[model samples]
Target: MTLNAAPRGLYFDDFEIGQEIVTSARTITLTDIVNFACLSGDFNEVHTNFEYCKTTAAGEPIAHGPLVYAVAAGLQYATGVNDGTLLALLQIDGWKMLSSVKHGDTIRLHSRVLEKKESSKGDRGVVTFLRQIIKHDGTTAQEMTAKYLYRRRPKA
Candidate 1:
């Protein structure tokens, strides 16, 4: 498959170690923060309180770290690289939030395949990806390495 084409969910053989995928951007909004707060029950003042956040370093409410991580995870799927071929998310490593994500910030994901190893049974492979959640101004807000299991395409 071509690099830029929409993958029909890649199989184990489709991933290359250095292949990179960029996803569409999503703007963070107050409603998103509020909804995430309600769903996650994370009501920290820095994330949910406008007046209270004015006294903090950011001077405005910031999105929750896990929320940003969740968005990044969704963005990876938006790329459609493993839409139908993914078996499971095996692990996450070295996840870090380097900068605060404030409301109105547009974010996108940049992911690169880091490693791939065939399973012992040979029906699937584990692929490791390094992902970055970047803001509109090119600031990296979060990063992590994720490992996913992908099925191998059946041989005819």
Candidate 2:
């Protein structure tokens, strides 16, 4: 967290180990894939061509792995949990693409706080969260651990 930033959302003091947050769902759209493909310059057939994908194990055009990751980040932001309290994303470690996300599959993010460490400087803290992207059918499509810098509670 920045020394001068004000806290408007969940500060480090408000978080506890094992706390969890669930986000609203969003359906993956073909538009999303196309836009992501265009944005990321990933024109791979598995994610862009259904006829070509029909020959793959997933059997159809599957969303790009990174696209689903971006959507998961959006879901977290939509929850308002990080509005102002989060300073920055320090790292994304142990990211795993457990399954494929297809067009029209509704998904939600399930995030659990794994750890919190108050900075030695005392103005900020570090927090790690385990996030899972869960499909409508209750399967996890992807998972990862993200570490973030966050503001501490302001002095009264």
Candidate number achieving the greatest TM-score relative to the actual structure: 2
* TM-score, cand. 2 vs. native: 0.94
Instruction: Provide the overall lDDT of each model, using Cα atoms, as 2-decimal numbers.
Output: 0.91, 0.92
**RMSD (CA, angstroms), candidate 1:** 4.5
Clashes (backbone N, CA, C under 3 Å), per candidate, total 0, 0
- Error (Å) of candidate 2 at residue 125 is 0.3
Estimate candidate 1's alpha-carbon lDDT, on a 0 to 1 scale.
0.91
| lDDT tens per residue, model 1, 1-156 | 656643489899999999998999999998889999999999999998889988999999999999998887788788778787999999989999999999999999998999999999899999999989999999999999999999998777
Tens-digit lDDT track of model 2 for 1-156 = 658655458998898999999999999999999999999999999999989998999898899999998998899899888988889999999999998999999999999999999999898999999989999999999999999999988898
What's the C-alpha lDDT at position 127 in model 1?
Answer: 92
| Model 2 accuracy (lDDT, Cα) | 0.92
In model 1, what are the clashing residue pairs, if there are any? none
TM-score of each: 0.93, 0.94
